[model samples]
Target: MTVRSIVKFPNPLLRAVAQPVELFDDDLQALASDLIDTMRAAPGIGITAPHIGILKRLVVIQLPSAAKPAIYVNPSVVQASTEMIRHEEGSVSMPGVTDDIERHARIRVRYQDLDGNERFEDAEGLLAVCHQHEIDQLDGLFWTHRLTRLKRDRLIKRYGKLIRAS
Candidate 1:
């Protein structure tokens, strides 16, 4: 597996809706592995294919205490708890900025395993937040879209300054 370059915000591919994975082959497994490596290199807990300019519905997540990374292909939230919780959210594509985003406290997601077997899992807390955030990316909704207009504008401005500084 190779670490892929992450596409930054304002990239058209980041805004494009990702296509569902239809083949469960070595290539698919390789992409998942690459995503894991890329996410770890980003020092982030979660990442999506779109982050690397691949418009595929794939996500990789490894919580701080996780023993190994989790891969989700064509994941969708089948159910979500009404209880909302706020979590500080950011993205690998847009680094150095984050804001409180309200999301379901728990969720049931349907996705395919590496072998293309359909599976379901319930997630809560940070796991749920991570899944929701990554799913949004698959749907072409960046995490900042969850923020208020004022907050979103401020974050974009801050990110611009950071880019300029670099």
Candidate 2:
């Protein structure tokens, strides 16, 4: 397995909708493995294929353990709660920034396992949040987009100022 480099924000690739996984072959499996390795190497809980500049609907999440790391291929939220929960969320693409965002506390996701078998699981807490976040990537959306326009403008200004300072 190899660790792929994650593309940062403002990259056009991150804005592009990901293509669904069509052929479940060794190449696809290797890509999933690479995603897991990349997430582990970055020491983050989750990553999407678009983060690596691959416009493919794939995501790897290893929140609490290395042993039971999850690979979600073509994942989608089947159900979500109206009652929301707030959590401090960060991203590999937007390093050095974190923000509290409201998300569904519980969700049911339908996705394919490593072998491309269909699976559905109910997740709550961090897992649910992670699922929503990664699925957003597939739709070409990020956590920043979930924020208010004023907040997003401030974040952009901060990033621009920091870049100039550096």
lDDT of each: 0.94, 0.88
Task: For model 2, name the residue pairs that clash.
Answer: none
Q: Residue 103 in model 2: shift from native, Å?
A: 0.6
Superposition TM-score, candidate 2 onto the true structure:
0.93
Error of 1 at 66 (Å): 0.3
Name the 10 consecutive residues with the lowest summed lDDT in model 1: 7-16
Deviating ranges (above 4 Å) for candidate 1: none
- Tell me the tens digit of each residue's lDDT in model 1 across 1-166: 8999999998888889999999999999999999999999997999999999999999999999999999999999999999999999998999998899999999999999989999999999999999999999999999998888999999999999999999
- Global lDDT of model 1: 0.94
Model 1 clashes, total count: 0
- Compose the digit string of candidate 2's lDDT tens values, residues 1-166: 9999989887878788999998899999899889888888776899998999999999988887447678899999999998899988878887767778899999999999878899998999999999999899899887889888998888877777766777
Using lDDT as the measure, which candidate wins? Answer: 1
